[model samples]
Target: MNTASSDQFNEYASIYEDMSQWPFRKYIEIPSVFQEIGDVDGLSILDFGCGTGMYARWLKQRGAGQVVGYDLTEGMLNYARRRAEKEDLDISFVSHLGPELIGQFDLVLGVYVLPYATTRPELQAMCADMVRLMRPGGRLLTLPIHPVYDPHPNYYEPYGFRLIAEDPENPYADGERVKLELCKNGEQGGVFAWYWSATSLERALEQAGLRSLKWRELSASAYPDANQAPKELHAYLQRPHSIIIEGVRG
Candidate 1:
């Protein structure tokens, strides 16, 4: 991670957890992720780039056999550990991953992790790391900028955030820069991410030995609270800004 990105996460770590509760995340992103993840009971799962470790704790509470939260930001990891302790969850929070983690997990959940790859090489290495941690036939689920991302940054404002592309004219160009804007505690904050075409993302995963590449749009109906969710949420789902990518480590 770049120094600026690291510093951004560390500085905003306190307000970061609120993101998990963002309208889109709660109604669409979260549901879409967990629905495809299916049964986690007795599954070994890794929450890569686990921001505040919300997913990590949730996985353990849901009966995941072994759950580990890994990230590069210390501030977030610190809060994650503290929360885990309070919940009396026996989840492990690691600051880094090594070869020891290879093939150690049955499922790897990398929510909003891939866009951090600022370059094609970085994307490839990140994919390699993801594939490295999964046992054979283990599945991977991740989210990245949708190839058909809405060009108007504010289109998702109703969802509490928006993404701006560095090259508006060529927003979907591989490795393009993108900015995510959000507000927390009445303060505005943002993070820089990259855009990877579906093709480029697939190539990286395939080269890393992940098979059965599949791309799908986020479905609001997958949400546990779908019935009560505002009908408007489906609009964002229809014009999704990010998409889900599923694969198996072969």
Candidate 2:
């Protein structure tokens, strides 16, 4: 992970939880994330790049036997530990992603974590590390920026952010960067992230000895109030803002 990017996440740690309530997350990302999770009961799970351990806590509540949340940011880890302590949840949050974290989990997952890999080596290292931390037959799930995503207003409008593509004609051409301008209550902030194509992601998984790969795009149907959405907005369900990749350790 890039040092500057890590710092940025630390700086945004306070607002991170609030962003979880963003329209896109509630209506699209969360649904898709849980769908990929399915049943975690009795499984020993690992949350890679866990920010504040939200998913870790959720998995524990879902009956996971054990949940370990690993993140590179200390600020996020501190928040995670505090929340878990206050709630009396038996989840562990660590600020390390190291070799000692090998072969101990039945399932490993991360939401919007891969974009932190700012280089090819970093990306490959992340995939390798994820597989190393999983047992044989253990599943790995990740939600990453969709290679096919575009700045279509109909879909992104409700999220209070505008996507500015550096290369409009070929924004999804593997390694492209997307700039995000976030708006909330008239305040604005900007950030950017990298996107990896499905092909590249698959290769990384394969190199890590994970197989039976599958991809699921984010959909509005994952939302609790999906049925109440206007008919015209149903089209947004088909246009994914993120992609979920799942595979099993070989």
Candidate 3:
């Protein structure tokens, strides 16, 4: 894995929260996923790729017994620490991969992280490792980029690729457009992103020995913006911008 790419997130660590809640409004399905998982009270939760502890904070607010936030980036950890301190949250932040980490949890979450993996094999390995961290019957929930979207024109610009389908009828149909751009500040060239489809993700999870409990395509329509959103965002909102998958570790 490219440790540098993992660490690059630290650069934006401090303001990561502000970036999302503000103009981007890149709503991740953390709260909804938690609701679906149901009653985390007295359960230990692990937030894999818990960038800046956004969801961790949410978990704390919702009354989890213990919430551990893990990230490969030190920068993100630094900001996460500060955020936790500011909020007086007692969450623990671990700077390690799933395999390297110890202990088990009742619930594990990977929100907006797997797609950033350097390779498919790494993603698979990470999924396996995540399952390993869960106790039997524990739940592993993740939101990965829907593969139903159009393929990227170029491999390097995985994040920059847009969804080409106009009206997607099913998870297999392509309806929304997505653009992911990863570049170094002031540097014209840097490492790029890779995309994943839902089928590929399911295969990885199946290989990891996780049994799918539920799967769904989530878009803005699932929320309040069903009627009013820009054409691009509207299409993505109607089509699935993300695939929410819940599996039980057996």
Candidate 4:
């Protein structure tokens, strides 16, 4: 990740927990993420790019064995560590990709992590990192911007964030810059990330020693709060802004 990206997320660290409370994330994204993760009981796991330790804590509480969270921003890592301490969760939070974490996890999960790679080589390195962290036969479950995300930035404003195409004329071009505007309850901030085409994403994972790559659409209807979700949820689901990709280490 670039300095600008780290600096941007450091600023967001203070409000990251609040943003995680957005209704879409609460009612849809969370369930979708966990559904793909499946049973974590006794499984050693790595929460790659685990901002705020949200999923790491949850995974630990759900019986994941030795859950560890890794990220690039110290601000984010500090928040995650503090939260883990407060919650009495024994998860480890680290900022570096050291040898200690390699080939040690039964599963590697990265939520919104791949997008932070601002270049294809960075993306490739990240995918390779995920593979390195996982033990043989371990799985990877990650979320990245949907290949068909809505080009209109404001379309998702109602849900507390916006996805702006950095290049308005060519939003979906491979490796194009995409700006994310996160807002809610009078607090707001934004960040820049790059978009990856489905082909590139798959190839990155495959080249990094992962196999059986699959993409699944997140459905608000599958959430337990589906009935309580507002009408806009259907539209969000129709043209989902994020997607799930899972594979096993070969």
- Residue-pair clashes per candidate: 0, 0, 9, 0
lDDT of 1 by residue, 1-250 (tens): 4445555688667667877788788777887888888899999999988988998988898899999898888888889999999999999899778778889999999988888887888899989998899999999999988888897978888777778998889888888999888743443778898989988999999999999998878877644554456787866866888889999999
User: What lDDT, from 0 to 1, does candidate 4 have?
Assistant: 0.86
Ten-residue segment with the worst summed lDDT in candidate 1?
221-230
Q: Model 1: number of clashes?
A: 0
Name the lDDT value of residue 52 in candidate 2: 83
lDDT of 4 by residue, 1-75 (tens): 655676788867767777667767876788888877888999999999898888999999999999999888888
List the candidate numbers ranked by lDDT, top first.
4, 1, 2, 3
Ranked by lDDT, the better of candidates 1 and 4 is 4
* Residue 166, model 3: Cα distance from true site in angstroms: 21
The residue-by-residue lDDT of candidate 3 on 80-124, one tens digit each, is: 889899999999998865554444789999887766665778878
Candidate 2 has which clashing residue pairs, if any?
none
Q: What is the Cα-based lDDT of residue 98 in candidate 1?
A: 76
Write down the TM-score for model 1.
0.93
Compared with the true structure, all predictions reach lDDT values of 0.85, 0.78, 0.66, 0.86
Model 1 stretches astray by more than 4 angstroms: 2-4, 184-187, 222-229
| TM-score of model 4 (CA atoms) | 0.95
